[model samples]
Target: MTELLDQVDWQGKLYSNGWRDASGGVLDSTEPATGAVLGQVGQADAADVAAATARAAEAQPSWAEQTGPARAALIRRAAAILSDNRAEFERWLVREGGAVPGKAAFEVELVLGELWEAAALPTQPWGHLLPTSEPGRESIARRVPLGVVGVISPWNFPQILSVRAIAPALALGNAVVLKPDAQTAISGGALVARLFEAAGLPDGLLHVLPGDAEPGAALAADPSVAMIAFTGSTAVGREVGAVAGRTLKRVSLELGGNNALIVLDDADLEVASSAGAWGAFLHQGQVCMTAGRHIVLESIADEYLERLAKRAANLPVGDPHTEQVALGPLINERQLANVDRIVTETVAAGAEIRAGGNYERLFYQPTVLAGVTTTMPAFREEIFGPVAPVVVVRDEAEAVRVANDTEYGLVAAIQTGSVDRGLDLARGLRTGIVHVNDQTLNNDAYAPFGGTGASGNGSRFGSQSSWDEFTQWQWVTSRKEAHGFPF
Candidate 1:
């Protein structure tokens, strides 16, 4: 047990200005794979959340006042520290978040890439100059930090999701107080705080308040926080957005998805099937951008579904810590029950279960369902599990129509032969990210990543988009000659 979960600092406590116990008491962090007791983590309440945010607020101005290059250097140093501690971070993911080795390593590298991405942001142009109409007057619109940001992250891909926003917020000169999900307190929250602190970041510049929704709500509603970056389900995001709206605070949400990988008639069945299998089963399909729906043309439906099922079954499924498992256990028993419910409903509704559907404790087998209808829960909602639902469409037009039928507009993928046709269909996708020949599970650090409609707010991350989300615009005008104005 020690060998499996070694290198994790699970002396669970709220890490604010420094380590402290939660006034609200403690919650046990368990390994979903083995149900082993990981540690007792401190659970912060509203007041604890307030204290963390207050400390961040106090440190923001000074951090923001630092030179842009200086800030970039610090961010780069943090990235270096993460790279140095890669093994420990990977262990934390497997022990705390139940991530398989491959998935755990992928997420760790992903967050590191995002940190390096933000390291360059301090030098990017955050504003532009416009042509002024008045004589001797210059107009410049510049983006400034929003002071302090509150980050609420979910259990799946916790570190990747939280730091995706946190790195950019810090690059833009905003201090952050992150409230990671109770399940990912150590991996997502404390790990981040540790890295930045090791990299010589000032105390109170970033705070990790590991707790439940009570602290999350308090952070979102806190007057000191200027913005809230939340990554979770649409239901919870709606509540977070409502609170942020009431407070008139800036909010960026990366919510749920019912994404599709549309395989047109001209698509290569083998290639398309592999892409679909990987996308749907990676990280147990907990990823928001995973292609849960396979909208394949009727011409290739049988072949694609058969191949996907075969690949899914062959994927190594075992103890994530001991074996080379591709699909790990769900985060906890709650997720196990949720996935079981959806698969059961879909099967009962005339959908054929083509592959694995059994569950052992928190470990759920990767499942594939065919003949799925749009109204089915498996097709309509975000499954957040390693379950693929196949929906056959008549043609390319119907494929597009069926894919766009959902309220989610997070990610859409198209696999087609003609480059022109692929480009055309990509343009018609209502989602934020569209993959022409690839899977929907593409999250490159250099790209502009986000979603539309219920999937997320219009806000984006990565490149220039990240800076835009954490900053406020200010217009400035300077005149060399004083002009007299008549009142």
Candidate 2:
């Protein structure tokens, strides 16, 4: 067991009846890299969902009753604890999620920063002082937590993705019923309970019910939950959104992406090549916002593609635990197969493999496919793997068109020597986040981050923006005397 998990207060209290289903069936949590039984993780069914929601609904009012300042204080304390134990948390992230150690540390550190930023929401919720009709009549708008928030996070960045959204929800004085991605249920659930206790969060304020779609859908469909926040595929996001919609509850979705990277004619060859490689291959390209499609202007398309192909081929691939590893394995065999299918299909469709398309023990070599057209399935879909498909474009206008051709608008990046040109191209891209001279996955704690179109419905881990997602604004007004109302 890792040091972080060993410190857990799991005296059969925080997690009980380990790895059992709602019907009391045991399921093993499989390690993605090796397909070994990591441990048993509890699986919640509809009944478990109901129970968790009931608990959350019951605790909601008292939690909401706490002043925002009080909640903020608790969040600040949590931030402190995260900073104090960053190493342990990062290690746990690597062991459980198969993230490269450096990337894991970066995400954990970002989570702590997010905690502190969310803590400041109490004193700085950007509500409005509405204009009043008459003098001596005062009107103001105040934001309040959406009681009983349902947070469903993905496994990609388990600790950061799960906690970042939950922190803001709790800091804004809401009770949370979280269902992390089943693959990372144990780590995510354990961290949530432990961090809350370490940070002094009120008992029963946060609950983790790890399970499958049955439980999650039930939770979202429940009328008791005021809001639902989810991070996953667009297909599932639509299903969850429909359920939440029917109940008239607030919903925030961070879905999948087939993000694009545009390398303009004026772009520095070296910089663009490096950025493109990282954007496409980082996280083994498992990130929703990974730049799967590389759009290079025709002027230097050949040279750019050649340089990127070399860089992709050279990235060190090995076990995540090894310090020499620059790229780790895909999350599971399913992901490996998914990438494999795309690679094989692209090749069959006449696209040439420029660098790599081989796999060994879950580790996939960084691949770059040349002469890929928009009609190819790899170009049309979210290839969440270490595969970069290069498409040549005539000019900036064509680059823009090709980048926006996809159904996914989660994130997009443009590289150009001219800042003005980059900004101009960026403004035209439909992605939720557009970057100039950098990749869209460049994370900042305070920025409103998420996606658009099929990519996502709203933001997360974005300081006050996340608070807004988890909170509701109420209009509070006082008058000198009761005014006569005409009904």
Measured against the true structure, the TM-scores of the candidates, in listed sequence, are: 0.95, 0.94
- Pairs that clash in candidate 2: 19-41
Residue 441's lDDT in candidate 1: 90
lDDT of 2: 0.81
In Å, residue 140's CA in model 1 sits off its true spot by: 2.9
Candidate 2 deviant stretches above 4 angstroms: 1-4, 8-26, 125-127, 134-137, 458-461, 483-487
lDDT of each: 0.87, 0.81
- Scored against the true structure, residue 203 in model 1 reaches a CA lDDT of 87
Write the residue-wise lDDT of candidate 1 on 24-57 in tens digits: 8888878888888877777889989888888888
lDDT of 2 by residue, 65-107 (tens): 8777887899989888777777777765676677888888888
- What is the lDDT, from 0 to 100, of the residue 336 in candidate 1? 79
